[model samples]
Structures are given as structure tokens and as C-alpha cells.
Target: MTTHSPHPVRPGHGLTVADAMDPCDYQIADDSTVDQADNILRSAHIDYLVVRDHNGRCEGLVTRTGLHPFLTGSWYTERTAVSTTTHQRGPFAWPSMGLSLAAIAMRVKRLAVWPVVDDDGYLLGVLTASRAAGVLDAVTTP
Candidate 1:
């Protein structure tokens, strides 16, 4: 996953998280039912969903693994909140963060999806590993 920038794109050369992040359509209300969250996850074909609070602020993230318990047997009939499935509260990135730095942070955090948020903790989008790799490819390729 090593990428050598083609030009002189230094650490703070202006390439940022916003440049590589995609619109976060995979978001669910914190109070949403597990079934509803599961439906969105299935429809979006994403690994996880960002759980937002009433103010549309990022509360945490819910992965499919977290919802597994509720998806099977009698639990499926019960009302489970998406927030209950969320474990990671943050390590969120700012839009102005340098892309390469953000990529490194993502690696260190072992995160496949990095939520990009504003100062107020509102989720702007997600910077997926694939997307970051794509940007690196574009920058490093001849």
C-alpha cells in the first residue's frame, strides 16, 4: 500500500480528506431499529453504518457483526436500537486533514472506514480504504 506521489505533493500540500471522502449515505438514526439498520446496510452494500443522534451528529458506528445477534432467531422480532450496536465513538477525521496523514491514521486505527466530521461532530462523509487507495493510485501512477 505504498504510494509515491508523482509531483511535489508534500504532507500539507493541500490534498485532504474531503478530496477522497465520499458522501455518507450510509447513515442511520441512533434510535433506529436493528431491522431498519440492517435494511440500510443491505441496500447500501456497505460494511457499516454511521449512527447519528437527534441533532444529526455522529454518535458512533454500527457494523454488520454488531447486528448479527439481533438478526437471528427470536431476537429478530424484538426492537433493538442501532445505537446499541455502535461501539466506536470516534477517531473521526476532519475534512481539512491531509490525505496521506489521514491514510496513515486509518491504517494505525485498523479502520476500513473513517468517518469525516465537522468541528460540531456532524458526519460529512466517509473515507473508505478503497477510496483512499484509489486516490493514492491516481497520485502515484504515471
Candidate 2:
């Protein structure tokens, strides 16, 4: 059996990752307190935070929904465990990937966002559902 790589998106379509992605820097160290993560998320007004390990490599993602139960209605505290609040590592994509296809896949998987990492797993940025929607809208709007 044989498999082949998918073709890259070309320029004529007016579809590209940069068209949808915003350069972002919301990250929290894995060992950091839940309070720290919450502060970053809230202050940035973003729904998710890229979790980084001690060496500052992308580890996983922490979302508002994942942290809500711990941060509300009585369990709220500065010392809540970041470990327990994280949604462990999931799929990631490369930066050059086309926005529309990536967005569709993420939506199908129910992922609000996904990380874009280099070959060495260094964090580049993210492809968010909102951004993807914008990309779809821009392409389909004509």
C-alpha cells in the first residue's frame, strides 16, 4: 500500500492561514498556578491559553470551559490545580496549512482552537474557530 501527501493550497484562491490568524502570545507555564492561568485568560479576553512546559515548549491547551467548574460556584481559589484544569494534548497543525480546511476539521472535532507548532514542537501561534469563521466569511462573501 502507498500513501501520498495532500497538495498545498495555491495562491489563486485567496485563502491562506495568515488571512485568518492573528499573531498571538497567550501562554502559561504548566507549573504555574491556576490563578495565573485564569488571570492570563481573563486579562487577554481569550477563551484559551497555550500551556507551556517549564522549558517553554507547547504542552497543551487550557480552555475557559475546562477551568470554569474549578473557578466558580464555591471551588474558586487561587490554588486550584492547573494540572486538573487542562485538556491534554490534542491535534496540532503546521503554519502553512490552509485556513478553510483546517477550520472545518477543527469544527468537526469540536475543537475551539488548535496550536500551530514548528517541526520541533515550538509554539508558533494558534488557529481559532473565530478566525477560521472570518476566513470562511471572507472567501464566501463575494
Candidate 3:
């Protein structure tokens, strides 16, 4: 009698998504409007804001690209502060995700920035696609 042995599964290796993602990332409150997010983006020199809840958990993300349209036409007024319109939904990735996966998501989604979350879905940090690409280029070129 011949018995077949079970195949052993290989564990995941390499840099997890958290490794590629920034941990001490900036975040904005959900109560903040589009206008506020825009000003913060410009001053902070960032394209995306991780929207946080009252408890400081990440809820969503707002991008300057999404806020730009609302500034045009009558939608915006002179008295309107950078806190009027609501921000767009946020995109997030898990820490266990691979760098390659993150890179693919950034390219296919055309995302300028992506937020990294913990196992509990708590906000971790922001990952700029440009920065990631630059780092990758440096590593691969050398």
C-alpha cells in the first residue's frame, strides 16, 4: 500500500505591506471638509489625507485631486474656508500585503497615495506612490 504525503505550504516572505508603508503618517479628522483637506495638502505638500474618526481610527482618505473640482464655479465662495465640502472616500491596504502588490495597486488605481492599516483596520501611515517608486528605482538600479 502506497500512501501520499501532504504537501507542505510555504509561508509568506519578503517585505510585507507595512514595511513599505510609512508608520508615522499624517492624518486629518473626518469632520474636516474638502476645503480644509486642500489647504492641508498644499501646505503639507501631500496629495492625500487619512481621515480619522473621533477615536483616531482611520475612516477614509481625501485627495487634492478630488477637492479641486469643488473649488471651481459657484460651489466655492470667498467666505468658504478650506473646511466646507466633504472629502472623498479613503483607500487602504493591509500591513501583510507585499510591496509588489502595493506597487500594482498604485499603478492600476492611479493612486497618488495609499494608507496602511493594522489588523484591526486602524490607521498606520501614508504611502506615496512616487516615493515608493523612487525607492524601488534606487534599489533596483544599484
Candidate number of the best lDDT: 1
Arranged by lDDT with the best first, the candidates are 1, 2, 3
* Model 2: lDDT of residue 24: 58
Ten residues in sequence with the least summed lDDT for candidate 2? 9-18
RMSD of each: 6.0, 5.9, 5.6
- Per-residue CA lDDT of candidate 2, range 13-52, in tens? 5565655666657888777778788888888898888888
Candidate 3 lDDT over 38-135, as tens digits, reads 77789989767777876777776767766777777575654543334455445578777776678788889877677777767687776778766765
Ranking by TM-score: 1, 2, 3
Give the 10-residue window scoring lowest on summed lDDT in candidate 3: 80-89
How do the predictions measure up, each by TM-score?
Answer: 0.81, 0.74, 0.68
Clashing pairs in 1: none
Which candidate would rank higher by lDDT, 1 or 2?
Answer: 1
Predicted candidate 1: what Cα RMSD to the true structure? Answer: 6.0
